[model samples]
Target chain A: MGSVVMHNVVSVDGFIADADDEVGPLFEWYGNGDVEIGAGCTVSKTSAAYVQPMWADLGVLVIGRHLFDLTNGWEGSPPAGEHVVVVSHRPRPEGWHPEASYFFVDDVARAVAKAGELAGDRTVGVAAGDVGGQALALGLVDEVAMDVVPVVFGSGKRYFGPVDSQHLLEDPHVVVQGDRVLHLRYKVRR
Target chain B: MGSVVMHNVVSVDGFIADADDEVGPLFEWYGNGDVEIGAGCTVSKTSAAYVQPMWADLGVLVIGRHLFDLTNGWEGSPPAGEHVVVVSHRPRPEGWHPEASYFFVDDVARAVAKAGELAGDRTVGVAAGDVGGQALALGLVDEVAMDVVPVVFGSGKRYFGPVDSQHLLEDPHVVVQGDRVLHLRYKVRR
Candidate 1:
C-alpha cells in the first residue's frame, strides 16, 4: 500500500482558508517566483525542487465534498494525481466530466482505502481539513505536509478541522525554504 | 531605542496555551534536549544557539495581566530581561515583589513605551497574546518570533489574540530546527 500524506498550504495561524473559503495569500508561492513546474504553476527554485517530485509521485487525491463543489473537483483534473476520491454523501454529479477519473465515497475511511487501492506504490495525497483530520485520527495518514505561509489569519477555516485530541508528529524530516513559504514534512508518530 | 519583538512558544495551530491557561505540550521543547540555556532551562543546541543571544540581549519583558496573574508575574523574576512591565487596569498587588523591577501600566502602548524606556539599547521582549496583539496593531512591534512546536491545538487562546486584520511579515530571516521545535523570526513588514 502507498503512504497517505495529508497536505495543505496553511497560514501561520493554521488556516487553509477563511470561513467564506477564501484562501487569501496561501497560494501566493505558486506564482511568486520564476521557476515553472508545469500546469501553469511557477514557484521559487527551492520550492520547485521540494514540491515537483512530490506532485509527480502523487497517484491519487482524497478531498472533502466542500472542495469538490468549490472548484468542481478542480474541473475534473486535480492539481496532481491521476485519480480523485471525494468524500461526499452525494454521488458524482451526473454527466459532469464523465471521462475523468473521480470517485465519490461517503465515508472518509472508505475514501482513503479506495485512494490507496488506486495509488498502488504511488503516494496518496489527502487534502487537509475535516476528511484529513478523520483519516489522521484513524491512523491512516502516514505523513503530514505543510507549505507554511507567513501571513496570520486570525479567524478562518482551520487546516486540522476540529481535532478533539492532540496528535504527535516526529520532527520534520524535510524543511525547505522558498520565496514566501516554508515547506515542512513530518512523519505521523504511530 | 530598542526593538520590540513579540515572542512565544506556539502550537502548530497558533495557540500559545489552552483556554484554561495551561500550556500543555507547547513547552515540551524547553526540557527535551541536552543543551543548557541557563535558569535551569535545557533545549536542543540548535535552539540554544538561535535563542540564547536573543535572550541575552533582552532588557525588558512586557506581558498581559492574565499572564501576570497566571504565574504571579513569574514570581517577580521574569524568564528573561531585567524588568517586567505588566499591562493591567488594576495596580500590582500591594507590596508584591517591590524589590523586583516590575512596573504596572494599564494600556498596552504605555506598557510597551515603559518597557522601551527600561530596555534602552537592549531588546524589549513582548509576550504574545492580547497585549502583544494590541501593541502590534498600534505599530509598536518590530518583529515576530515564534518557537513552533509540532502539535496542533484544535482551539485555544491564540498567539495573536483577536487580531481583526491581517498583518504581513517579511519572509523569516531565521529558521532553526531544534529537537521538537522550529524557531522562526520574521520582521513585521512596514
Candidate 2:
C-alpha cells in the first residue's frame, strides 16, 4: 500500500507566498542543479542521486485547480509522469483528457481516493497548499516535508489556512539544503 | 557605540508561545546542562563556555512591561546583570528601585536611547516580543537571532507584530542544535 505526502517550501514566518504572490526568494535554494540537501546538513551532491529517486516513487499527485492553472496543466506532462487529480468546483478546462493522466474532481476526499486508485503501488504526492492542508486536517495525509527558507515576508498566505483541530507529528527527518535552507520531514500522527 | 539585537525561540508556525501562554516544549532544548549556542548552531558545551560570555558583553537590555511582570523583573538580576530598561505607559510598580539597574520608561525610543547610554561600549539586547517587533518596525534593530523548534503550534503571538514597513534581512547564520533545534541568526539591513 502507498501513502499520501505533502511538501512545500515556506518562509521563516510560515508564509508560502508574499502579498505580491512571489515565491522566488523562498525557493531560491531549489531548481538549481548544484545544491544538495540531505543527512541533516546542506552539502554538495547530485540531485539525481538523492532527489530524483523520491520523485520516481510518486505515482500520482493531488493538487488544487489554482495550481493546475498556474502551470498550464503542467504542460500535459506532470512531474515524474505521475497522474494528477485537480480538485475544483468549476468544470474541467476545455480539451482536457483522462488519457493524459489528468482528472478534475469536485472535493478533496474523492481526489485523494482517486489518486490512491490511480497510484497502484506507489505513493500519492499532494502538491496544492489548500488541498494538502485540507488533507492534513482530515487526517488523510501520512507525511509532510517542508523546506523552510530563512526569510520573513511580514505577511502572506499561510500554508495551513485554518485547521480547527490539532494533529501531532512524530520526530522528523531533518536536513539542511544549500547554505541555509532547512529541510524537514515528519510523519503525521493519526 | 552599541548594537540592538532581538532573540527568541519560535515554532515552525512562528509562534513564540502556545495559546495557554506556556513556552514549555518550545524551550525543551534549552535549560539542559550540555547545550551551547553560537553563530547559529547549538553545540554541546557548558553555559559558561558558550552563553554566559555573550551575556557578559551585553551592557543593557530593553524589554516590555508585560515581560517585566511575567518574570518579576527577571528576578532582580537581568541576564549578565545588564542594565534593564522596561518600556511601558503605566506608572512604575511600587517599590521599584534604580539600584537594581532597572528603569521604567513610557516610550520605545527613550528606552533604546537609555539602553544605549547605559550600554556604552557593549551591545544592548531587546528582550520583549512587542518591543522587539516595534524596534524592527522603526528600523532600530540591528540583528535577529531565533532558536527554531521543530513543533508547530497552530497559533500564538508572532515575534514580529504589525510592522509599519518592510525590513530586508541578509543571509542568515544557521545551525542544528541538540538534534531537532535550529539556531538562526540574521543581520538587519538598514
Candidate 3:
C-alpha cells in the first residue's frame, strides 16, 4: 500500500486558517517565487523541488467535508491527484460534478482506506484538519508534512484539529527552505 | 544596544508548555544527546553548534514573573546570561538570591530596557510567553528563535502568549536539524 501523508500550510502558531476560514498570508509562498510548477502556482525552486514531486505522486486526496464545502471540491479539479475522498456523514450532493472522481465516506478510517485503495502504489495526501487529526489518532497516517509560513495567527482553526492526546513523530527527514515557507516532513512513529 | 531575541522550545502545535506549566517532552532535547554544552546539559553536536553561540552571547535574560516563580528563577543560576530581569508588578522577594544578578521590574518595556543596558553589546534573550509577546508587539524584539520539538500538545500555554495581531518575520536564516528538535531563527520584520 502507498503511504498516507497528512499535510497543510500552517502559521508559525499552528493555525491552518482564521476562524472565518480565511487563509490570510498562509498561501503567499505559492505566488512569491519565480518558479512555476502548475495550475497557476509559482514557488521558489527550492519549494518546487520539494513540493512538485509530492504533488505528482499523489494518487488520491482525503479531505474533510468542511473543505469539500469550502472549495466545492476544488471545482472538480484538485490541485493534485485523480481522486478525492471526503470524510463526512452526509452523502454526496445529488448531481454534483458527476464526472469527478470524488468519494464521500462517513468515517475517517474508512475514508483513508478507500483513498489507499484508489491510490494503489502512489501516495495518498490527507488534508490536515479534523479528519486528518482523526486519521492520525487512528494510526492511519504514515507521514506528517507541513509548509510553515512565517506569520503567527494568535487564535484560529488549528492544524491538528480536535486531537486531544499527544502524538510523537520522528525527526523530520525532509527540511526544505523556500521563499516564504519552510517545508518539513516527519514520519509518524509507530 | 544588543539584539533582543525571544526564545523558547515549543511543540509543533506552538505551545511552550502545558496548562500546568509543565514542559513535558519539549525540553527532552536538552539532554538527549552526547555533546555536553554546559551545566550538565547535553545535546546533539548539531544542536550544540547552533545553540552554544547563542548562549555564549547572552548577557541578560528577561522573563515573565510566572516563569520566574515556576522555576524560582532557575534557583538564581540561569541557563545563560549574567543578569536576569524578571517582569513583575511586585518587587523581588526579600533577601531572595540577593547575590545573584536578578532584577525585578514592573513593566515589560522597562525590563527590556534594563536588560539591554545590562547586556551592552551582548545579546539579550527573552523567554517566550506573555512578556515576550508584549515585547514583540512593542517592537522591542529583534528576532524569534524556536527549538521546535516533534510532539503535538493539543492545547496548552501558547508560545506567543496573548498576542492577537499578526506579525511578519523574515524567512528563517538559521535552520538546524537536531535530535528531537529543529532549531529555527527568524528576524522580525521591522
Candidate 4:
C-alpha cells in the first residue's frame, strides 16, 4: 500500500489567522516558487515548469471540509490517481467529482482506511485543520513533511492539531535551499 | 507623543510554528513579498529605498525580549528622536547604543512611558509582544499594524502575554494587497 501522508505549509507560533477565514499571502508565483499570495502581485522563485510536475504525483487528496471548500470544489481530481476525500459531517454535493471521483468520511480511521484502500499503489494525503493530528492520533499517517516559513503569526487558529510526546516520532530529514523556507520530512517512530 | 503600531506576518491559524517549529515550504523565495520577515536568502523588503526615509521619522522602538534577542541586538537605538526600549526584567548589555540609546525596563508601562517621552515628534513603532501587550492593556499603545501570512503554525509562543479584555482596541483598518498580505492597523479604543 502507498503511504498516507499529511502535508502543508506552516508558520512559527501556532495560530493561522487573527480572525475569520483569512488565508494570508501563500504563493505569489504559480509556475515558479515566486508566486504571489495576497492581492494581485506576481512573484516567482520556483517556476511552474519545476512545480507543475509535482502536482502530477499527488495520488489521493484527503482534506477537512474547510480546505475542500477553500478550493471552491475539488473538480478534476488530478491525473495519475488524484482521488479527493473530505473529513466532515456535511453531505457531499451532487456530482462533486466526475470521472476520477472523491470521497468524504467523517471518521478518522475510516477515512484513512478508505484512502489507503483507494490509494491502491499511490499516496494518500490530507489537508486542513486538525486532520493531520487526527490521522497521527489514529496511527494512520506514515510520513510528515512541512515547509517552515520564518514569519511569526501571533494569534488566530492554531495548526499543531495534536502533537504530544506520546507519538515519539523520529527520523527527521531536512531540505534547505532558501532562508525563508525549510522543508522537513519525518516518519512516525512506531 | 508617538504612535504605537504593530506589524507582523502571521499564519492563517495564528501560530509562528508547528509543535517543533515546522513552517512548511511557504517561504522558499524569501523576497517574494514587498514585506519580508526574518533571516533568509533575501534582502529585507520593507527596508527598501522608499522606506529609508521613514526610519528617520521613527521615534521609539518597542520590542519584547524574544524579538530583541532574535535580531541579535537592537538596531543601535532609533535615529534621533528615538529610544530602543527592550522590555525585560533583567538588564541589557552595555555599549548596545552609542549614547544613552537603549533602555531595559521591568515594567511595560515604564518602558512605554519613557519611550513616549523620548519620542518627541515621531511615532513609536513597536515590535510588540507579551509585555508590549501589557502596555496596550494599560492603555499606552495607540495603534497596531500587522502583516498576516498565509500558512498555519499550529503551535508556539504567542504574541501577547495574556488578556481578560479591558474593552480596548479599535477596529482594524485592514488592507488586502495582491501579495496575499493583509496590512491590518488597529487603534487603542477607549
Q: What is the DockQ of each candidate?
A: 0.74, 0.33, 0.85, 0.07
**Model 2 fnat?**
0.23
Residue B103 of candidate 2: its Cα lDDT?
86
TM per prediction: 0.97, 0.82, 0.97, 0.50
The sequence of per-residue lDDT tens digits that candidate 1 reaches over residues B87-134 is: 999998997988999999999889999999999999999999898888
lDDT of 2 by residue, B1-190 (tens): 7778887877766777766667766766554445545333344453235345666678988988888888888677875545889899887677765468788899888898899999998988986368888888777888887766766576777777655334566657545454345666688866
Which DockQ value does candidate 2 get?
0.33
In candidate 4, residue A154 scores what lDDT?
A: 41
Q: Which of 2 and 3 is the better model by lDDT?
A: 3
Off by over 4 Å in 2: A31-51, A164-167, B31-53, B79-81, B164-166
Write one digit per residue (lDDT tens) for candidate 4, span B52-117. Answer: 444556777777776677664546643334468878887886655557577788777787777788
In candidate 4, stretches whose alpha carbon ends up further than 4 angstroms from where it belongs are A15-18, A29-54, A76-81, A95-100, A162-171, A178-180, B1-104, B108-190
Q: What local lDDT does model 2 show for residue B52? A: 54
Best of the candidates, lDDT: 3
Q: How well is candidate 4 docked (DockQ)?
A: 0.07
lDDT tens digits, residue span B1-190, model 3: 9899999999998999888888889989999999999967899999999999999999999999998988888889988988999999989989788789999999999999999999999999999989998899898999999999999888788889988878889999999999999999999998
List ranges where model 3 is wrong by over 4 Å: none
Docking class of 1: medium
**Pairs in clash, predicted candidate 2:** none
**What is candidate 2's lDDT per residue for A1-190, written digit by digit as tens?**
5989887777767777876667857765554445444322233354334455667788998988888888878676886536888899986778765458788899999999999999998989887368888888877888877766766677876766455334566656645454446666777766
Which of 1 and 2 is the better model by lDDT?
A: 1
Clashing pairs in 1: none
